[model samples]
Target: MIEFWLCAGLLLLTALAFVLIPVLRGRKLQAEEDRTALNVTLYQERLQDLQAQNAAGALNAEQLAAGRDEAARELLADTEGAQALPPQRTLGIKVPLVFALLMPLLGYGLYQHWGAIDDVERARTFADQPKTIEEMTARLEAAVKSDPKSAESWYFLGRTYMAQERAADAAQAFERAIEVAGRAPELLGQWAQALYFAGGKQWTPQLQALTDEALKADPAEVTSLGLLGIAAYESGQFKQAIGHWQQLVAVLPAEDPSRQAIQGGIDRAREQLGEPVEEAAVSAGPGLTVQVALADDLQAKVQPGDAVFIFARAVSGPPMPLAVKRLTVADLPAEVRLSDSDAMMPQLKISGFEQVQLVARISRSGNATAGEWVGSSLPLASKTTEPQQLLIDSADSKAP
Candidate 1:
């Protein structure tokens, strides 16, 4: 903010210089003209005295002629090298001087009305990572204040408020986001979640309506699915809870950490209804088991946190993965199962393809399509039940 104000001050000074420099020059030219007029007046008075002397016979004609020549010479000397001045403008100097005086005030006024100085300050504040939740909340609040129309800002601010357990504030932030960005399915889901918490976790018609609207727009919307499951469980609707959670489990990626918690909720709901827990039912699908390991030489180059993507891609169809599982380099040498339930999309599943290629890639940046190290197996039957060995043993020549 200080830097912004400093730059503005410098620019204002430059503008004043442009306006006032010419006015100063005009004043100096006027002074020179005044001096020339005085010199001409002295020359005229000397000529008049000489003419008076000649008329009184106090001096001979030649003497008078000499005095006249002297006066003329003196006059010429005084006016020598004077350039003819251009016609002066009636308002040039005065107008610019007045404008120069008002420029700073007018600029400040216009800027206060329309400038993005607060945005500049917010940008500078956001450049550095916030070290605490309070700091993060403060930064996010300022960001929304600076750019109320920025749906992204409002969305993140709402998320931050949620983290801080300020449910009411979070609800308001999400509402603002919906106003700016429209009722996007994700935003609707978040807004419903916030409102539910803000209303003391009690299920309400408003909450139900919001979730319904969100799911109507996007059936796979995760937040609404989870929130609905929770509400059903709390209300003793075990069967409804199970249904909602199962749908959520189906849409979530296989490697999502939240899957375990959600599955726990499903099992609890089933137990509440006196049904036997069925773990296999959740993951039952055609799958390929693979043992993945990092290359010995490249192990030293990778960090424990580096992302390892293990997936199967169709050999004769689209390049998109049939199924995928994500892990970290620290989890290398571990066995993973890529199954129909792990499919990236519902229509694209391991069972849908005839032949597939198994791939293991290590990416420092967590991108599945491109990575630093990769290994792949030749095309094989998608229904192959045998476990296979895959290694990240080669540099990824196709990495971008």
Candidate 2:
């Protein structure tokens, strides 16, 4: 700010010079013009005295003429040689002075109106290096208060809060950051991490949602992979933790400080499982508990041996099921659990989607893709905790 004022003052001074220099020169020229006028008046008086002497017979004609000529020569010498000056320019000091004063005032006014003063203040707020994590967190909190619209400020504040283990505050800050900066993968991961910690690392459906959404946006998002691994490890799913951490390690830079810690975590997971987990370990997401029953009217329509296929598919993604479970009409009114352990493929699981649709179909033709009777639940979170009840009453005449 001091430098800013210094530069502004210099510019204002330059403008004043432009306005005042000409006014000062005009004053000098006016003085010379006054002297020239005085010389002309004196010359006229001397001529008049010479004519009076000639008329009064005080001097001969020659003397009178010589006296008049001498006056003229003196006038020329005084006016041209001593008092000569450039032509006078019309100048009003009042206007120039007014403009000179207004120059600085106007500059200051415009700066106050449009300058990036808030940005400067934000810089200052962050410039004072903090000696400890607490100090850094306080500074970042101040910065965000000063500039609430700055997404960058909020992000750093959230990270600092995380370092302090203030998970709820960190979650709020990260949510604000995402609101301002858009749902970029990195921001989403931070939001998920904060929420995950805030909930005591219980790995709620919402946390799973945030992480899944982040990974969907960016497959190699390191933060999402790390959080997923941590959640799996917490839930005693060491094989699944190994799979997620392996993916995280593959994308991390060789020199990254977290790389060693992540590798250590992976090693621990392997030891827990007593083996090097392969892709097979990837099938470790929580199962969905559901009660499926035949509608009273459709009880006769479904045969006892008719294959009942229960599956989960992303609400807005590929047609393939993330996980599936097979049953029969005889299993109607039975409780079943569909899980990643029942994944249709090694690479796909319920954990891959933020929201999922539950589907149950009676494929009498033995074609799982095209069935005779099907029922579907509206999209629910993939990690929904409470058991869902579904009725198999709808026709599945439409093509898949």
Name the candidate that leads on lDDT: 1
Ten-residue region with minimum lDDT total, candidate 2: 276-285
Using Cα atoms with residue i matched to residue i, what is each candidate's TM-score against the true structure? 0.64, 0.53
| Residue-level lDDT tens digits of model 2 in 1-400 | 7887788788778888888999998887787888989988998888888888888999889998899889888888887755456564474789888888888888888988998888887787767545444566677788788779999889888876664458899999999999999999999998999999998898888888888899999999988999999999999999899889999988876544356457768878987978763443222236687888888999877789998888788786666666666788987888777766455443456777789999888888655667888888998998897999888898997535
Off by over 4 Å in 2: 3-7, 38-83, 88-91, 109-129, 142-150, 202-206, 235-242, 254-260, 263-400
| TM-score, model 1 to reference | 0.64
Query: How do the residues 1-400 of candidate 1 rate in per-residue lDDT, one tens digit apiece?
Result: 6777899999999999988888888888887787888989999899899999999999999999999899889888988877678877656576898899899999999999998777777778878755444666788887887779999889888876775558899999999999998999999999999999999889999999999999999999999999999999999999999999999999998756457667878999989999999765543346788999888999789999999889998887767666778889999899988876566544567888899999999889876768999999989999898999998899898688
lDDT of model 1, residue 105: 96
Q: Which candidate is the best by TM-score?
A: 1
Go through the candidates in order and give each one's C-alpha lDDT: 0.85, 0.80
Error of 2 at 48 (Å): 6.2
